[model samples]
Target: MKTALLLSGGMDSIALAWWKRPELAFTVDYGQLAATAEISASAAICSALDIPHTVLRFDAKALGSGDMAGTAPDPNAPASDWWPYRNQLLVTLVAMKAVATGVQRLWLGTVASDGIHKDGTPEFFENINRLLSHQEGGIVVEAPAIGLRTADLIRQSDIPRSMLAWAHSCHKADVPCCHCRGCNKHFETLQELDADVATGD
Candidate 1:
């Protein structure tokens, strides 16, 4: 259907990229501390997979909270690395771009564990899809990995460990710090699946 994926250069997203193999991928730098690493990783994966890739740049740092923005995770934050409707914001941006390029479907990397965040729920995707579908282009928002955890998706997709190496999961550092929540999940998932993770820049 001429799909596009919102590739975040993280484990789940990378797995989804290999699983769906969309025609194109989009990486947005909404002022995250790890934007540079994320974009580079995403671009490299896209190039290797022979998928067209693009980076959408903007400064949403003022709207961000927690480690992603160089601040402590707020005790009352909506979620770790919370950025105030981050998925919603990214979806809107990608939808606009996708519609312009004749893309009919847009995919996100949300996984089962991400349900803790309101925006990661199935209802959110359904609602967002409805909103976008009502528009002129009818670009649909779908989260193909919402039913599986990171480890499950990785194992199920059978994505090569070498290609999965292109993902950068640390929220605070260009090179993975291996201590943050994101990095912890990435490493833990690889360990659980008994996959050798490629580290370092």
Candidate 2:
């Protein structure tokens, strides 16, 4: 089946890309603070992997809240980086583009830890999958690493450190702030991977 990945240039997504090697990849610039860096990183990896990469641009900053939008977090935000319905919006947008390309499956970068947000849960994927499948395109959305942690996904993907280093996980800027949740996760995942290697895991 033809598959396409929502490549965000974050550790999780990058690892998923390397592991799945989808036929195509889509990077959406929804007016996020790190859109430029994310696009650059994603393009570089896609080039190296010889996967066709398409960038979809849509300005939704007015609809966003939290670190990614450079705005205050929504009152109901579950995390500092929360953007309401972000995953839903992104999945919908990607599916819109992917369906036209005859893509039968759309992959997300969500991992187990992301379940802190409702959208990142398995039920969310199942619900969204049903919603999308009920539509004309019948595209299925899946997150293969949803059951695993970031470090585990990295190990399973067996991505080279050099390639993985190209990921840009800063949620607040093109250059990593190192203080944001995204940056924290990036560093933590790397440390975990290093620890595993050192212990021969």
Best candidate, lDDT: 2
Candidate 1 residue pairs that clash: none
Q: Who wins the TM-score comparison?
A: 2
Taking all chains together, the TM-score of candidate 1 against the true structure is: 0.93
Q: For model 1, what is the C-alpha lDDT against the true structure?
A: 0.89
Compared to the true structure, candidate 2 yields what TM-score? 0.98
C-alpha lDDT of all candidate models, in order: 0.89, 0.95
lDDT of candidate 1 over 36-125, digit per residue (tens) = 999999998898889999999988988888889998777988767776788999998888787889999999999998888889899999
RMSD of each candidate? Answer: 3.7, 0.8
Q: Give the per-residue lDDT digits (tens) of candidate 2, residues 1-201.
A: 999999999999999999989999999999999999999999989999999999999999999999999999888899988998999999999999999999999999999999999999999999999999899989999999999999999999999999999999999999999999999999998998889889998
**Model 2: how far residue 60 lies from native, Å:** 0.1
- Against the hidden true structure, what lDDT does model 2 obtain? 0.95
TM-score of each: 0.93, 0.98
C-alpha root-mean-square deviation, candidate 2 = 0.8
